[model samples]
Target: MPSGPWKNLSADFCGPLPTGEYLFVVIDEYSRFPVVEIVKSTSANETIPIVDKLISIFGLPKVIKTDNGSPFNSHAFKEFAENTGFHHRRITPRWPKTNSQAESFNKPMMKAVLAARIERRNWQQEPFKFFRQYRGTPHPSTGFAPFSLLFNRETRTKLPQVPTYKPNAVDECARQNDEVAKRKMKQNATFNNSPNDIHCGDVVLMKNEQKNNKLAPNLDPKPYNVVAKKGGMVTVSSTSGMEKNVTRNTSCFKRIPNTLAPGSVEPEVAEGEELILERKDEQVPISDSKSMPMQNAAPTLAPETIPKSKPTVQFSDKRTTPASNVTEPYITRSGRIVRKPAVF
Candidate 1:
């Protein structure tokens, strides 16, 4: 947990708005003090400067949390993190709640923008106004205004108030209240109690984060094989070579039945080929010459096939006739008659 404001920070992008601008929001994890920047793009080049400006104001944060977005996952962002001397912690893919601070702030910021859009006011100006109001107001979790927590002083807002002496118990009170709120939140979330059932070697389906249509299913239909598992993190390799291997939280995966064949594609039959279906209960005798493959058939085997050596000598097709004194003949499951020889 973050011990104080600016120790830990979280960031996320809000949009490509009507004006084709994106709101790049960064918030101090402890104080919930947000710094909003209207970026032309969410590229690492654009975002890194904004983050550097914030660092200039608040000093470098120990850790910066973000989602597995392209900007954050890029090599440039990685180099930026190394150069800036801050740990860049990316949250689980497909799970927004992991970066709750930035995600929660995005809601009210969007609502403010929507309000401005409806009222025919400047959308960009309204979100900053909303941020000012949010900073002055008391946060529900910590019971302290974001400005007060960040600066350790009373924030002057539109509402008139007598300037009073700042209390020294602010940090202690915020910590206690934040801990209680977190405990309550944990208790209320039922998923916190659910066990991680996914494991290495399990065949699974990932939660599809990028759905092109509303009709798309929540979980991807393509199967993946769990190549590794470390605590809650799972490394899955796509069974169908279409996608690259991805490492994500176990919650992003749904364990499928082991019977499923990963990346398996059914072979297409050629123009003159016949499709043969076999049943488990039906037994074809090896001695039946008609059931044998054509002598001149291709020697190459399918990937799943296990080759067996041919017999050195072939058996005769001729069968011995049953004696007339034989009592009775036994019938097998496949309706083949078995004649027993008379006892000496």
Candidate 2:
């Protein structure tokens, strides 16, 4: 026999600290009937009492499956299960699919919370109100409200209802008709096909290393579109019109149904000096002109002056000399001519 709804809770409220808004969801595996409880916290110590109350109301199931979380693995839970004689099963570490029954309920519950948050914007204080609305609603599959399924009747509410005559016979006939219509609809919608073969105009997904530079050597799936078909090879075109021939085998390309066309794949251009020059006629000098030989103008150097530390002694007593005696000569320190000056 199929299992009942996966029962678990998640914390969805975020605040300066956690608002303690925990989501408790129970889904029927066969009917998908959901019974959710939104509470401030679901600590094992705190949750034990809540679970006890729920079990008291719904009766203990043969088995309960949950993730390997601290609350589920707590000694209190273990002892409670042992005493109650309810089989407790925990999912393997890091494996969420093992507990998919609970995880699947998260999608619609989250959608409800999001919708409520958008409408009210202050959902933290009124989580229970949303939970009540969700629980009281009729499930699509079971054709029974969660409250009705759990309690065997419609729960009382403050809302007004129009007076109507009780016609149980008429209601039963209407339900039968609805069930027949639903069965017919399901039968008509069923499709039989192996999960392969690219359909014409069906946006088939493919992976090409030539398209994705970062893809590893191993044939991990990437995304491309099937543009045209020829025998076993399909002509695949990227958003950029870069076409490639691919095999129909699923090992080569994983087909993703109902995906939006990917954005254009821009061709990767290599950036280099040659490319830059091609784009713009701008030249950058590699070396300075001084480093290379210049065709014109000699390079000039200035004279260097030497400095003497000692002062020269003056031996001559007479200070003045006649113009005729002041001949153009090179005089030594003893006043003797060292050499006659050459005529210009």
Highest TM-score against the true fold, candidate: 1
**Residue-wise lDDT of candidate 1 within 226-296, one digit each (tens)?**
99988778999987567788999888999988666565654544554433423345332333233334444
- The C-alpha lDDT values of all candidates are 0.80, 0.55
Q: What is the TM-score of each candidate against the true structure?
A: 0.48, 0.37
The Cα error of candidate 2 at residue 291, in Å, is: 99
In model 2, state the lDDT of residue 95.
Answer: 76
The positional error of residue 141 in candidate 1, measured at the CA in angstroms, is: 0.4
Best by lDDT: 1
> In model 2, where do residues sit more than 4 Å from their true spots?
1-20, 28-33, 38-42, 119-133, 136-138, 141-144, 152-344
| Residue range 1-344, candidate 2, lDDT tens digits | 25443233221112112354676665555434455565566668766776677678666666667777677879989999899877877768887777665686677656655776679766544556755776677766667666666545576667775554355887899999999999988677554424457755555555444544554454324456676766556666554456565555443565655544454343444432121111134322222233322334322211221112222233388454333322332324432223233222
Positional deviation of residue 86's Cα in model 1 after best superposition, in angstroms: 0.6
